[model samples]
Target chain A: MGKNLREPLLKLLIEQKEGYISGEEISQRLICSRTAIWKHINELRSEGYQIEAKPKAGYRLVYRPDRVAPEELIPHLSTTSIGRAVRYQRSVPSTQSLAHEWAKEGAQEGSLYLTEEQTAGRGRMGRIWHSPTHSGIWMSLILRPPIPLNQSPQLTLLTSVAITRALRKQTNLPIQIKWPNDLLIHGKKVCGILTELRGEQDQVHYVVQGIGINVNATESVWPEELRPIATSLAIEGGRTFSRPELIGAICGELETLYDGYLSYGFTPIRILWEEYAGMLGQEVTARTGQGSVKGIAKGLAETGALLLETHTGVQTIFSSDIEW
Target chain B: MGKNLREPLLKLLIEQKEGYISGEEISQRLICSRTAIWKHINELRSEGYQIEAKPKAGYRLVYRPDRVAPEELIPHLSTTSIGRAVRYQRSVPSTQSLAHEWAKEGAQEGSLYLTEEQTAGRGRMGRIWHSPTHSGIWMSLILRPPIPLNQSPQLTLLTSVAITRALRKQTNLPIQIKWPNDLLIHGKKVCGILTELRGEQDQVHYVVQGIGINVNATESVWPEELRPIATSLAIEGGRTFSRPELIGAICGELETLYDGYLSYGFTPIRILWEEYAGMLGQEVTARTGQGSVKGIAKGLAETGALLLETHTGVQTIFSSDIEW
Candidate 1:
């Protein structure tokens, strides 16, 4: 049933690569298929894929959806995954939630979870993130680093550097990583990271790094409130870029940073981070649970802690909400 | 069946608290269950409850197993749980392993796990712990702390103070909290802590604290190889201590320490830890995955990261296998 219905449609498209195949030819090739091919083609078009099919000419591949495709991406994909194994969804509540479930089900290292939009996406401090359907890159990567639980915080800092590097290296647009996990393009946020982990008492079992990047999105696609603070590559560069290429670049950068952090502490990554980090050695305020501490950011500590020189002495901030 | 089994057993041992009860009286009080009473008594004896069945005097309750009972241990339990709810097993491969499964099954915060003998108990650095059946407190506490994933290492250091305080207050035996999470009595290992967390992205869903304390083990029971390095409470105090009491005390202390960390930051617990920690201010060397660092153990920073004064400068030690 599956092979016969699509074989004629495939052959017609292959023969007439210039344009669409007539419904009569499609019907004659399979002998029981013109309507079947039309139905299946409609389904494909609904997935943001621009399939131009006319009454006489047949079908034309006008636009391919700018999403991650395994066949097209895997060859150029570097870093042995961190995304090689993938589960893709057109829509989901959040990539982070599904990644945790997969990790619990014994999903191995290098598992990647991708979704078109997050219905209940959240940023650090429980803030809601504006994730519109098919306008952003929403994905989570699962990794089992051979490190203790105490050192997991460094992973988040390291991930931020990787995202910053990828956005810069893969595209001509300038990017800067804000303190914690915000990715900024020319002083406006372009992406954010949320790192999660699961483990057994002091030993880290796995980590899920969720990244959401605003790409190919119009300024109007964001809420009336977010336009001032957020921008997509399409908005900044006047053209939309391929999401799969961006994903490939980020995952490759992340795996490289992970190797550096694992083998040789955070020294090398810190140097790379210092180059792309915003607000370093600048006066900023961090609102932790207790209250707020306004101080000069003194760069990162050796063990990957954010050091802030506060009025009450050099108060080394380990974990908190950073406000510039 | 359950009622008949419990009532007769309770009635037979009501007045005969201090000494043994005769087997015949046990059979008689059980009424339609003379043979049934004998079978139940055998079951009770196997649970490490001391039942002396003297000649014609009947079965007496000489001793009860010194471990937390889900019934008796529930009410006096304090703290927002973190282990207020209880689940126990007589023998299990590992409490941490079982707890991970429970967490997957949506185990609530304060849900606890305990086992009498851990056939495959584990410690930090992937080492095996000597968990001789009913001779120590082998338990795991489930905590759902709402902190960022990276901030979890502080919870490990915070759990150490709780264990140390509970050991001192309940057992009246002084114990030193080793850096990160190890309990030492008279400079010999007696207890260890392993903290695990579950989360996705920025928010931490849960943190499970697994603690093992050697309460009633004798020096002879200690392996000849480990005798020089490890000592149990019985060996240190020259007497057998109650396991249930120690477990209850630890739970109570954990709740308090957790409260302080969540509300007031790690400062309160870090200050208290400074008082009980044996590693602080001492010249020591620690082996982390990255490399070894030798330095004077300063106090913990605000984020629970260990501050070590090495030859170069004050270095923050996150996770390490101590070589003191």
Candidate 2:
């Protein structure tokens, strides 16, 4: 069977979602042999699409696997730019590394690299990001923004706003953004954003934003050590959400926010970011390499640096681990 | 006969610089046959080293090629860190590209990628850097600085100071730094520096400083359009200089300046840069993408941006071409 027949067959199945269509009907619609139809059905099954083949009834898509496959996500994606050219992988070491490689080879501005499982997922400061299989969003987005190198930190904050807004639309639970790039819900981290940039002094060549979200993972999926600090959407809401729909929402939100950022500047995004930032006006401690800084988390600077008011003065924290 | 024999024979020739060493004597000293010694001499000649051979008089070293080979440059290098591991290439697309690749693969700090000729050399703001064969220093140095992303432009200014000081020590010609990263002699461009960096918001992964100096090119060596604006050391000084020694001096000066910048801060380097800057206090027009700003070139900011005092106000130019 030709590879081109799979999409047409998928379209036929989706169009006839009411009931199963006969093999003769499918063959007539797709202009292929019954044997070829069966081959494509097996291929779709191997790709984690559950198809029930009865004796009288021909075939029906019984269940769609919880994967961010291009076939599953592309149809639901509403963004015109982001996630348009998706590089879907079943398993990889890190989507950020792959995205960096592709960006070096001149990947498009809005190209996305997504994976089902990350063998060596990484977070900020060389920490391990626990990316379990088929239960979260493990993706990296490549953006070529014509901004100064100093303004790159603001992208992380802007991405935090986008992710938080996307999640807020999907669930009834409250979403709050931690200082730099962590998305928390109910006082536990549910998402992490790591933004890496490569460029010269004045201009940015490309920025890779790697985001890992715990969407559908249950309480039991997290390791013992991480259970106290981490929680997923399923654990908080007691339901498994559609990973494709969630990914689509995130991409659309990010694209809209990113475009606004580039057009009107960081002022709009900064305002939105502060609304979701739960740390502002609260007392917190930032653990830096030098020492610990205890202060009132005043707000974010226009450049997206954390402005903390301590006893000494106002300190601008570029990077640090936060503790309330 | 073998690649190993070339180095031993070259070592013998250097050791016996004042006199010719016979093939039989070289074979006895290095445990190789006379025919093998002759073959290695032919290989050395193919590599652009001029060797004179007379019947029964054996071979003598006549001239060393103006190539930035590891063997030629490493012995003269005095730096403890910079240019420690030199990856010499006869020809490459661009040393910056190669250095970026090596840095991505975890190349050590201070590793250098040097090329004799670049097929696609790059300048600032997508300009074409004319790199001819064996007439300039076309190299990139990798640095891993632990600083904020905003402080990276200071490195470019620091590197400009290093190159100016290095050239000033080697020659009596007056060397002047033009605002950001151009080194000029007699009001014409003699060298250019391009600094590229990769990092996150707070920590830098690596920085590739690509420096190209027009060292030994004659007036005719430059392209017709570039002859008026571009000049080389050989053209200005009326003599060819030793490229290896100049490269060694630049590397040593850069390593010293970089170490000082890391330990103390950008203050020392900024002071040195001001001393070498000739554009300060002069009226110039900065041709930026937005528009042109005509003002007196005041000085550099602590962050290394060019400060211009126009009629309206003081403007900081992040990137632009200067015209006086």
Candidate 3:
């Protein structure tokens, strides 16, 4: 069968999720032979799709493997712009790098880059993020909001709120956000956000928000050093969650929050973030480029800088690594 | 003549600027035949180098072109970092565009991109800047400063001070800076600075500072709409200036100011900018994304935001278009 039929076939199967579709009906709808349908089903199976075939029942999708292909996420997406266009790769060095290139090439707002594995995954401060294949959500989004260049960091905090809300809704795991952007489950790091931007002195041109989530990976996926500090949904929740469903929920929540931000300002995001913050009102030490400061985590400033109450006064931490 | 010998030949001619080098001496120094030396001299002459050739005296460097080639600016440059590595193009759409590309490719700090003309020159707020061939200083510099992302705009203001100081020393044309970055001569804009940056949410990775100067262009360079607002050094000073010399001076001044900025902070830059600012204490209207606000231009905030004293109170304008 033609490669173009793969997406239509997947969509057809998704639309008929309650029942099976006969091979003759699928072949007729796809303008192909039954043998071609059989071959395509085999291809899909190889890509980790579980398709049950019975003599009279024809074909039924039993389960979808943890893949973030557009076809897999399309049916679950509820946002108009967030996932309207997605570039999927089985493996990449970094989705953030690709997102930057696409943004420079004038990619529309809300364009997304999703990868199954990132051979050279990147985290904040140039740290390495381990993204294994078929086990996590490694994605980057391109946003062109009309915000001042200095206020761009608020989007990172806003994204943390979006992801936390989505994770809580999907897995019922008490996911919480650290001061700026790290998402935690059971007091361990589960997600990290890296926000990069290009802009003029006053106006922001585009922002690339990269999110790496540990979804279904087991303990072996992480190195020994990270084994104690890192965790996944399966490890923490004791149940596997669909990667596509999680991505779809995150995108939808982000779109709603982003719209609210554009209309009502950062107050909504700030409130949501404060509610989901796991470190608020706690004594923490923030290590910055200048030096380290110990203070109580009050909340985020209007511009998303962490407001730390210290001995000196109320200090706004623009960028730093936090430890409680 | 081999292209590789061109730079050495030019250097030799420059070293013999007071007198002339014999044809035999030139051929011997450059490791080429006398005939080859003659051909290379002809090529240099075609590139606007006034090489005086005498039967017995040989070749003398009478006058260097207004080009901003590395060789032309090398002798005039006195800085350690700025303009150390030069990328020259005869004609480009915009040095700013090329600078962004080079910055992403790991272009080091102080890498300079100079173009004789910018076919699609840009100004602040997406306006068109007139960059005529061989009559303007059209260049971009890549800088990687270790500063918070919110403080990035200070570099733009610092650059204005650098350019104003340089132009004052070179042309003595009473250059003044408009709020943010427009350099005005006699209330007409003679230079504009466009500062672009790429960075994380908190720290800046790199900044591309694009400076467009209307140097030697006459009244014909400006469009009808820009005629009343634009002026050049030649028109204001009534004499043409060397583009390479101006570039070298500006780069040197920028390096000095940037070093001071990273050490003592934005205080010195703010003090100098306040001195050179023409609109200080004047009533002006700033058109921001939200709306317009009229106020007295008090000065710049600590983070380089325009501090505007309005009837309501002092407002820190992060991004806006200002008019008097």
Candidate 4:
């Protein structure tokens, strides 16, 4: 019922090696009823983890499913509370939409959002993001930074740094971050991040970073035609990688980078992002609202905008869809 | 219903001389129905207008409402399309809240919002705005401009220009716009504006302009002490003005200025706003989140930020609550 209940239960279940635990021990330590423990277990099942239980043997979490659940994920996270609060929804129209609303209604800082499905998910071009129920990780991170609105593009680099570092740390599959907001595997799309901001004149209240990664989704789960162009971690890894582990690692990485940026500016994250951005120094094209322009990518400016050295001059692209 | 529906109805109803007409006439000419006519009529009544009816005499408009409504107010409104789309709620918690939700739902450009009451109104200094039910114009404008995020503060100046023009044109009561976001009546406060932006990295998605004006509210409406610092349009004019008329006029003015900004930019509105800002040359004390400072108001910068010539230098305040 409370956001705290699931967290302690998750830590308890993880520590018990056989995944078998007596309900009595959990009740004595956490000071909750066996019924409360069962309820959270049921909630965890609803969020897609598998548990085997017997009346006499108590409950046994036999399968820690690769799914997004705060309780199962947060305990393993090595974070300084950048994403200390995890809000998970069974299904939402858009993670960014719900995150934006929650941020306005006074959601806490570093609130990490996870949704099993996004019915009306959004992409960069105001297009519908296809989030076929529980097939991928669809979530948004809400960050309230003490920074100017113009400096917000720096957050894109910061998030790329966090996500790229997280993927590198948790998975063996090679993931490359393209300029702006793309993640690719073997040059096929694997993930995308869209950062939206709300502010007072020039002060940014919060940035809702929506990241959708194709995880265990196979070709069958994807739309028929998209199978050729899109991929998931399962396809790339030849096995289903753990979603909770990936999410936990991402939250920790994000927290570390966000804290660093707030304290010391974007220098730390910017350096890391440059390493992961494979499109730097390559022939690139950007599709702005005006029109598409081709240029040699000259890396990013200190402000985090993409520096596209064009035929005329170097243009700082504050926003665009990148192709390299 | 679309906001433009009322403008033609206002003209047609006025031509009938008598304020009363049969529901059949409205339905027949407008190709609507008796039910729709009655529904909109009921809506106009909630906005504080009085109507009378008899079987043979049909319906008679006993008195024009003082509050803002689409029908009576939109007729006199002059603009291409700003006030053309109007939505009104009698007792919403806040107009800004309504506008924000609507914006996400793909509400159109130049949408005009008005509310009779705000259960939780807000002021610049995180203070509660005294908005008695049916006592003030608690409204917000939702705009989706083509400009980048940095150019958004000009919207505040554009909004001030529209509001000041509407107040001057309607009341002859003469009001001045204080730097940042307050509208002054003689010496006391009459209106306030809160501008919030939603952007994509560096591109602005939408801007919600929240405006609260004390129209028909009396001194008694204020908690005993606030009477000295706050005054209403009704008190200043010595007569209750129709809020619907004023609302329509302001929407019209806003549309004009908004169009002016899109076509010609904020230079015109900036010049116009400077004339009404009386503290431009005066020594004033400002309390910001950083601290308090005594400075002379040099003028407004090109981007609509107030240029405060402090002891250190001319600081451009992009976001702050100013009290003079």
TM-score of 4: 0.68
lDDT of 2 by residue, B1-324 (tens): 477787778888988876888888988888988788878888677555789997898889998777789998987899888999889888899999999989888888889999888989998866899887788899999999887677788988988999899898997779999977799998999999998988887677789999999998777766799989999988888898888999999989999999998889999998898889888899999987568999999888877899999999999887788988
Write model 1 residue lDDT over B106-164, tens digit each, in one string: 89977889888888988876688888877888888787887766677778778888888
Q: How far does residue B102 in candidate 1 sit from its true spot (Å)?
A: 4.2
- Tell me how each candidate scores on DockQ against the true complex: 0.35, 0.45, 0.56, 0.35
TM-score of each: 0.78, 0.80, 0.82, 0.68
lDDT of 3 by residue, B1-324 (tens): 487888899899888758989999888777899888888889777555689888887889998767888898999999999999899987899999999999989998999999888999988767787887777899999999998788898999999999999999999989999978799988998999999989997689999999999988778766788889989999999888988888889988999999999899999999999999999999999999889999999999988999999999999998888999
True contacts kept of each: 0.56, 0.63, 0.76, 0.69
Q: Which candidate is the best by DockQ?
A: 3
Q: TM for chain B in all models?
A: 0.81, 0.82, 0.81, 0.77
TM-score of chain B of 3: 0.81
Cα interface RMSD of each candidate = 3.5, 1.8, 1.2, 2.8
Candidate 4, B224-244: lDDT as tens digits: 889888988889999887777
Best by lDDT: 3
Model 4 residue B145 lDDT score: 91
- lDDT for each residue of candidate 4 in A7-61, tens digit (9 for 90 to 100): 7888888787685788898899889888888889998875556777777777777
Please report the candidate that would top TM-score against the real structure: 3
A201-240: candidate 2 lDDT, tens digit per residue: 6678999999999987866767899999899988898888
Better of 1 and 2 by DockQ: 2
